[model samples]
Target chain A: MGHGPGYVEADEDMSNPLGLKAKLGLDVFKHDKEPHITIKAGMAGDQRLKKAIIVCPAGLYSENAQGEVELTIDGCLECGTCLLACGSEVLGWQYPNGGAGVQFRFG
Target chain B: MSQASTFDVIVVGAGLAGLAAAYTMAREGLEVLVLERGEYPGSKNVTGGRLYLNPIRDMFPDLWAKAPLERHIAHEEVCLLDTEGAVTVRYDGAELGTQPYQSYSILRAKFDKWLGKQAERQGAMIVTKSRVDEVLFENGAVVGMRAGGEELRTNVVIAADGVLSFIAEKAGLREPFKAHDFAVGLKEIIELPRETLEARFNLQGDEGVARLYMGDVTKGKFGGGFLYTNKESISLGIVAGIEALNEAPSTIAASQMLEEFKLRPEVARLIAGGETAEYSAHVIPEGGLHAFGKFFGSGILVAGDAAGFSMNIGVTVRGMEYALASGYLAAQAVIRAKQKEDYSAAALSEYERLLKESFVMKDFENFKDSLHALENPRLFTYYPRLAGDVMRDLYEIPAGPKARIFPTIRKYFSVGELWGMGRDMWRLMKI
Candidate 1:
């Protein structure tokens, strides 16, 4: 997913366990390798497994063993700068249902 | 039992308030239908985009276990700023880290969609892309709602259709909201690396911080800006009063003001190297407690922004909590009215009374002046510039003989034209 400047390619070398770093503001290439932290809950899917976790590194999108995971996130502070700059469709977005989602606890 | 109707109850708007009301009624065995004008719930909703947990505690006690929470807010910083600097007051607590968290950061698309699904699971029929054209009335009493050229009957009507609800207006529950009574807000959700977010704001784990800015960010206009930390993204935006904005010397639209706001050195540094994820705009009812119009009519009830219940007190922007609380209370009233087999205005007036009894109305009532003070222009304009100038002179390390800070402040205060600073401060004090 890191195709822009300073993007260190994700190595296909199976023998090398090290994950390559992506460009600034882009990281989900080998995010799955960031350790399988158990979530215990918070996912929607086959729930037979008593424990599950998906690691999404902090750049808005997180990748897991199941590939890019899509989750509904709310309570976002309304800042239009990032959306004005995002050039992807992976993020399905809108304000929290009116009267739902993030309240500027202190604004 | 061949009742000729699409559902027993028809809810217009798929927002949280609407969904909550529909869900509550449906869970109790009523055949409820939710009609949304957007492609989906939250699609047309806009908030500072933060969801407080107080209102949802009863409905989804284990929400953190299932709902998508961007970040659990552990610290909140409310900053008063000038062109060059800021003074921030922070309220940090370890209590916020646990269950029943004070608040969480969220993206509405995900939150509202999930909420709609939850409502659907409770047996309410949620229909999207259906605009409610009018409220169906019989003998001056609301009997149902009309949407997309289709009329649907119900025992009650919920107008949770957001700030400019036509249904409420059409029902004579509210008038067309004046520009001064409302605010135009523009926001952007920017994505950043988890490590970067944590490092920049000194956050640990999933803990997040919310920041509010007043003063120069709005070009001394009667509005403020906010920056909140999410899981891997930051929500940044500006909300300004439309009347004050229109009265400004410059033609900076809400969108343009947001652009300028983000470019400020303080905000720009935080979002530096971050990727813009989404851009959205919406209006907020900052009319405070005095703006709440008639909340209910014959067989109808209104909650959330539709009723002009948002409060814009300094350091706080509360609507969601009010919306959810009011929604729940409205549902309770509706259930009682249903049991009594009466949907008249008298039967439904319970919603208004109960809402007034709840903290929703109390808080709005207490801080009515805060909303007025925010619109006074001094907090956004003169103070920021004067304060910034003061800070620059006091903090700057000069090469020659040091000028005493007190005298500098006195001289500075004497030098600049305060332009109603005294009156603004006096009124703000009362606020």
Candidate 2:
């Protein structure tokens, strides 16, 4: 299902994950900001399940070579997808400081 | 304890709800303060971006003349897509384009900012870029809000904060919304030249179209997709209940679902030559009243998405109306509470009373079944495909005797599918 015509490849000129974000003017997102989420150390060690790596809407969580879940907090959409998907046992979710996170131009 | 730290009412979040509530209170001559976490109101929000005006007309009678409205939606459609083609149910009329219009598409940043300005003019203090870290309490009664390491007192605190509001949790009203209780949405505002947009969408000046897509968009998930036209831009996106999404046979990412929908020839044409303008994702409450939190407790009253006032009523998903309505009601309740000199849960109960007495509650009651029908995968998946197939067969123009419409539709529907739809129809009648 992933390979066939059932799947539509994003335009070649477009970047799958970010081309849209760039056009959305998210490049000016508050990148130099505080982290609103705390990923438990060795969360990947349990390896029981790391759904956050796959389920985050922003694709913010990815597995590192060391089997650690590396999170790119700067691009976090703050939609709380990962927060809800991660469960409290694995993550500490908090809103970004008053004005220190991704901002939507037309939201 | 200086006067500067006190207010008659304080609203958290400056989205439609907070602004409406603040404006209502301010208009009553109460000192209202609204703290928004965004750089400006709506900087952290996302919407399919359409505001149905009839519901909010009383709150802002001359909204059309003063609000930063994009366009009055005169054209609307529901596009059912199978793999290669689409079956569209289009509705258009001059009546829909008249004053006190059916609806208008909006950009939250612009609309919310305008709303905040309106509240300010009515004596409300709208503080953008200030987040309410938590709800402040005194002697087990909600009293004010703490933000940025500072505590400010208010006779009442209205949590107009969006969904996933920690303020709700801070008040012990409820925990963070679970994935099953809500759907995650991702949207992109594509910038298009007005002439090109008008030409492609067959729109005249200041006219717009809103489209809701089923099938193939969410890859047959419980939620669907939307395309709303804003004067020079188009908002398109998919919303899938995270529970259904996580349970799907495929691990389709949200962005992948949107990309596939954008690439569909049916959608591509409408957005051709348009530049991607904004990308955003938000969590919308899907579960109706069942998943909603308490309306008021002590001095804290939760409204908007924070209280789960939004709904996904089949094809016409609604939030802004409920948010604005609840905000208006909450403000009215706060005014009454101040008059009674009691912000207790009992005194603030008026908020829920106003809601129960308004369409906000009645509509939720009325559409409970429709929402039920929508949650059934068949509504978004099987039925659209079946409808699309029947529509396809009817119009294929093959050189043969024409097939009867009933049998043609039945040919695509199994006995079980028929039963399900029959039940859906019956339940819809009850609604």
For each model, chain A TM-score?
Answer: 0.32, 0.69
| lDDT, model 2, position B327 | 93
Q: Kindly list the per-residue Cα lDDT of model 1 for residues A1-107, writing each as its tens digit.
A: 22555533222331121211221223111111121122223332333111111111112223357643333232233322222222112222233332332232212
Q: What is the Cα-based lDDT of residue B47 in candidate 1?
A: 69
TM-score of each: 0.77, 0.92
Give model 2's DockQ, 2 decimals: 0.40
lDDT of 1 by residue, B1-431 (tens): 22356566677888878988887887888888888866667766666757888755775553457987788889889777776777677888778777768788887777888888888888999987676766778899888865656667878888998876768878998754555677667666778999999999999899899999998777777779988888888999887765565454654444446656776778888998886655555667888766777899998899887888788777778788777777778888888988898989999999989987888877877787887776666677666677677778878888998888898888655534554666677787856
- Candidate 2, residue B343: Cα displacement in angstroms equals 1.2
For candidate 2, write residues A5-93 as lDDT tens digits.
22322465444555433433432377536688977775755442356654566777767787777776767788887777667677877
Best by lDDT: 2
Docking class of 2: acceptable
Interface RMSD of 1: 15.3
What is the alpha-carbon RMSD of candidate 2 to the true structure?
4.2
